[model samples]
Target: MQAESVGIVAGMALVLKFGRGDAARCRFAISPLQETMSALLVLKDPGRHGWYLPWLRDVEPVVAGLDLGLLGLAVPSNGHGPDFLWPSPTSPLTRIEDDLAQVRATDPAVVAAELAEQARRLDRHTVPGDLYRALTGDPVAARETLVAQQRTAWRALVEPLWDRMRGLLDADITTRARQLADGGLEGLFADLHRRATWKNDELHLTGFRDGTVDLRGRGLILVPTAFGWPNLGIGPTDNTSATSPALVYPMLGTARLWEPATQSPAIVRLLGSGRASVLTETFIPSTTRSLAQRVDLAPATVSEHLAVLRAAGLVTAKRRGREVLYGQTPLSAALLNLDRF
Candidate 1:
């Protein structure tokens, strides 16, 4: 059955009802294409998404050369865009090529309908004349054009920085998995987003169009995205052909994702420059070797600082196989004014 908007509250909420086996079926995924589409919104209004300004500044040249007329029209500042652009990821490691292929393979009829829907949402009866004519005249070609543009966008914006982005995304998934294991679905949803809530087997997301989606045991896909800050996205809302429903939410550690770790003067005064720099970089988990490379310190020196910090209750170390990963403790986050979200 198709999910439909049920009722409207003062603050809109999209409610996804979980069935008997739905809880077990829910899983986390990382999508490069989803990040690409979200990045477009940031590009459209960089002021609104200040977290991405650092990235924007770096890609300004690429942004200036590209033709964003079509993509810009599709993804407005309000963040509602075509569903076909973001197909539900089948696995945790869904690739951009596979997602782009799914988009390219979209039915021409579906493309036409979605374009019309976008136009309607933008308060216009139809799209711009030339684009409308192109859609009505030959949707397959239009689809190809859109996909080609998307590929260009992926190469220019997301590809070069994917490793860093993926590291952040993977860390979030690891945290979510731990939440699921320790406290079950409740723990997972509790921290998913401030706008998301879990109650009575129903997952309600605020700031979304009111809807009731009965999963019917098909389950839900939880996607962690780097560029999906300050908003939650529900997919396959009404009339799209996706196997399962998905929720795209901003991941943790985004506020500092683009910023370089510098020694805070106050921190430095207290812990000395070397330890403070190591502490600053430990906000996100890293190994001693990686931390050394990042802070331009020797591995032994970083390890010594980590030992001191760990002994002082400022850092914690977890052993994963042969490598030991170090991360900040709650005390360290409070000291650094870092958001643990």
Candidate 2:
């Protein structure tokens, strides 16, 4: 069946089945972030966001809101209603978490330290100038400062709550609902990818489509979403949800991503190496140093190459520890997979 049809049907089945209890349990487990994400999600993706939980499997792990694709907490989390769900009537110092009593449905204390720390760092208390100006209906005059502050508070909010085994949420009615709505996470992400920007780090997908899965691996790591499942798994050349372990953690850039991520800088370089100007239909990575290594190349040369690949929409890069790590643009990756199949 078409992914569209499959996703829709599966979603319907999920609501019919787990709509009440399990869904509530799942919501109860996390901080107000889930609610904020769900709210903001409604803005960008009404269908997937509107009381309808988006699902995914064999796909890019996406969190909610404008569907923020981890621009990096050098970059952070976003969404609407955070103030309401994880409300903070006071500023700079206030409890920004939701009532754990509700999510006691999950073992909150099990992940309490992490959760407490996260709550302590929320946007509500540490209102970034950008967030304050933006929320208080201030002018964009201090936009840059606002943006910086926003990033800080945002990262604080995003840095925790990846692990939550809300007892009632697992193997419950809600889980069944998601299952019915989605063959699994793979189906959900596929459908959402089609509806939102499904890029690597550039926000380029603009609601692109998917191809076949030609790879899978144990190196894979999945980040959990508000829905209580890993949003998507980053695996080696070959990885899939069915084979990988479900995961959660502090932040995307944590060393753990490297530990479990099957992401290959080598493959990215090999795939993107191309001097053929008229734009050879396909750029193949056939270089040493793996586009990620910036050892010998002059900083200018590296910049030029990155600019080119980024322009061609072949790869993605984010500055890390004074270095830029590049990877396949989600669209490009999907395209290559389509070719492979």
lDDT of 2 by residue, 29-148 (tens): 123333233223333343542223322221114333322321121112321111112211111111224322222222323223323333344566555554443333322222233233
Provide the lDDT at 78 for model 1: 64
Q: What stretches of model 1 exceed 4 Å from their correct place?
A: 1-11, 122-128, 239-242, 263-341
Which residue pairs of candidate 1 clash? none
Provide the RMSD of all predictions against the true structure, rounded to 1 decimal.
Answer: 5.5, 20.3
Flag regions of model 2 displaced more than 4 Å.
Answer: 1-32, 35-227, 230-303, 311-313, 316-341
Cα lDDT for residue 202, model 1? 93
lDDT of 1 by residue, 18-56 (tens): 889999999988788889888887786688666677898
Against the hidden reference, what TM-scores do the models get? 0.75, 0.21
lDDT of 2: 0.29
